[model samples]
Target: MAIRNVLQLGDPGLRVVSEPVADPGAPEIAALLTDLQDTLTHWRTTTTYGRGIAAPQIGVPLRVIFLHLEQPWPLINPTIIAHSEEQMVVWDACLSFLCIFCQVWRYQQVDVRYQDLQGAWHTVHAEGDLAELLQHEIDHLDGILALDRMTDIRTMCTREEFEKRYRERSPYAR
Candidate 1:
């Protein structure tokens, strides 16, 4: 597993919609899951901001995502099977976006169906931050972002405000 460079906003590769892994059991897909896990671990140790990562974020054009809670768990060819009727709004900041965050509406809960790194299938019913993160990462695979999910772009914070709110993690000063 290697620590792959995350693609920036201007990178054309990020715009490409990822292709689904038809055979989640294939070695190539398995290797991708391993790499995703490595990135999850690398960011956890290096940045202290490892939570969720999408393949598209790392320039991998596959329908793969890693949702590493405090524990490392990989989601390969993930699909959201169900979601709560109730919706909630949260401030979302992408690793790709650095300091920027937008108020995005998402379901309060989501039932996810995905394959594990070992190619075994599993189902997860999650709410709150986990649900929000799944929706967010899946959005990335579909070439979408928090900005796109927001009802109003005006609600998004100015860079100054964003930096003030997330002072330590803000990349604006960089």
Candidate 2:
């Protein structure tokens, strides 16, 4: 269980649709979760931004997501159960594309069902940034990147540009 190299943008492995995690308690699943935690921690420590990561981002094509919000945890075989009609656009980034951010529209609210490492099932209702984060990570399971979700191609910009133009200068600052 070590920090694994994150698959960069354009890696073919990043496009593979992740398979459902059949056994949440499998040793491989545990190892993958550990790798995700280590990798996400390393990224956040260095960049000050990563909050969540998906298994596929680390070359493990399994439906798993590691989140470091108020608490750190893993969601195994996550699926969106419901979404609100209202949508909002926000700047989204990815571990695969560490240098850029894209404006993407996502549902304002979502209900997700997922399993724990112990194989127990649970559901979570998320909204705002947490909802957006869940949707972003779930999209990775289907081979979708934040770039692919952009409503306007022109909205994509380098992280440095994003910081200069919008980080604290605009109302869109996240």
Best by TM-score: 2
TM-scores, all candidates, are 0.83, 0.94
* Candidate 2: clashing pairs of residues: none
Q: Write the per-residue lDDT of candidate 1 for residues 1-174, one digit (tens) a residue.
A: 787777777777777898877787788876777777787677667755557889998888888998776576778778899999999887676777655667789999999888875678899998987888899999888888777788678767754586577545432222
Best by lDDT: 2
List, residue by residue over 7-113, the lDDT tens digit for candidate 2: 99989998899999999999989888988999999998887778899999988899999998878989999999999999999888888997988899999999999
Give candidate 1 regions above 4 Å deviation: 158-160, 163-174
**Candidate 2: residue 37 lDDT (0-100):** 95
Worst 10 residues of 2 by lDDT: 165-174
- What is the TM-score of candidate 2? 0.94
What local distance difference test score does each model get? 0.78, 0.90
